[model samples]
Target: MDKFDKKILTALHENARISYAELARRVNLSAPAVADRVEKLEHAGVITGYHARINPAKIGYPIQGLIELTVKHQDYYIVMEQLGTMPEILECFSVTGTSGLLLKVAVHSMPDLQALIARLMQYGDTKTSIVIDVPVPLRMPEVVETE
Candidate 1:
């Protein structure tokens, strides 16, 4: 990607909903040019997709947590598929180390979290931590284009 493309990505990373005109202004390009570049970025898979960042608590989900799971090697794919069907498990990653998976979960109450944990426990050993507050929640990455 060129400098202009890097600028376009940085702008989108900061504000995914930014208007073409505004984006062009920030990158010193015409609106149509900005639109074309964004389309190319999407086609090239640099820009995956856009999403709304919603506060879980504001939507009645007051509990947020992280879970570490250790599952049977043979049951790995089965457990991953099961996790995909659970809405409470917002995100899951198969990471390196002793643990098989790391998960980000949300729920309306402690009781809900408990029930969810009970079901998850059937698949493997689990370690969970409830988040009481987030000082700096999620953030965008800084992209530095290489020569």
Candidate 2:
């Protein structure tokens, strides 16, 4: 990747919907050149996918929380499969330390969260924490020139 590629990536990270002409202007490249570079980036898997950020509270899921679960060694994959079927689970990660998995969940109410936890406990012990605020929301990695 060259400087122009990095600039194109940085611009796209700021706004994925930017037109090729605008991107070309920002990167000092022709529209066709910018499009070709973006295509190459996509093919190389440097650009995975684009997404829209949503507010759970506005969408009727006001309660948000983190769940730390420590599952038995034999039930790890089974628990992961079950978690995939649960819509309330927004994200799940296989983590280290005492916890085997960490899950980000959103629900309509405390009762909903309670029910989800009760279901998860069937796998193993769980620690749940309600999220009051998110000071720094998810941000894409900023592309920078390498030495």
Candidate 3:
């Protein structure tokens, strides 16, 4: 990838829905050139997927939390697969240390959280911490040095 490719990626990070013509204009490239670059990026897996940000409060799930789980043995993949199917579990990770998995969850209320935790009991021991505020939510990927 060259400087032009980097510029194109930066622009796409800001707005993935930008038209090919508009992207070409901003990047100072012809539409076909821009299209070719973007296609290459997509094929190479540099551009994985596109998504829209949604407000949890607007969706009736106002509460957000992180859950730390300690499972018996090393059955993280099985437990993670189950968590993935649950609507309340927004994100899940297989982590290092005593806590085998960490999960980001969103729910309607404390009662909902409690119910979710109860269900998770079948899998393993769990602890939860409610999020007070997200000072910095997830951001778009920025340019990074590659060896």
Candidate 3 stretches greater than 4 Å from native: 145-147
lDDT of 3 by residue, 25-139 (tens): 9999999999999999899998898778788979999999999988877676787778879999998887899988898999999999999999898899899999989899766
Which candidate, 1 or 2, would have the higher lDDT against the true structure?
2
lDDT of 1 by residue, 1-147 (tens): 889998998888789999999999999999999999999989989889998899888999989999999999999999999999999999999988878799999999899999999999999999999988889867767667766
Global fold similarity of model 2 (TM-score): 0.91
Question: How far does residue 39 in candidate 3 sit from its true spot (Å)?
Answer: 1.1
Q: Which one wins on lDDT?
A: 2
Candidate 1 regions exceeding 4 Å error are none
3-120 in candidate 2: lDDT tens per residue?
9989988888888999999999999999999999999999999999876778999999999999999999999999899999999999999998999899999999999999999999
CA lDDT of each prediction against the hidden true structure: 0.92, 0.93, 0.88
**Taking the candidates one at a time, how many backbone clashes does each contain?**
0, 0, 0
Model 3, residue 139: what's the lDDT?
A: 69
Give TM-scores for every candidate, taking all chains together and pairing residue i with residue i. 0.94, 0.91, 0.89
Descending-lDDT candidate ranking: 2, 1, 3
Best by TM-score: 1
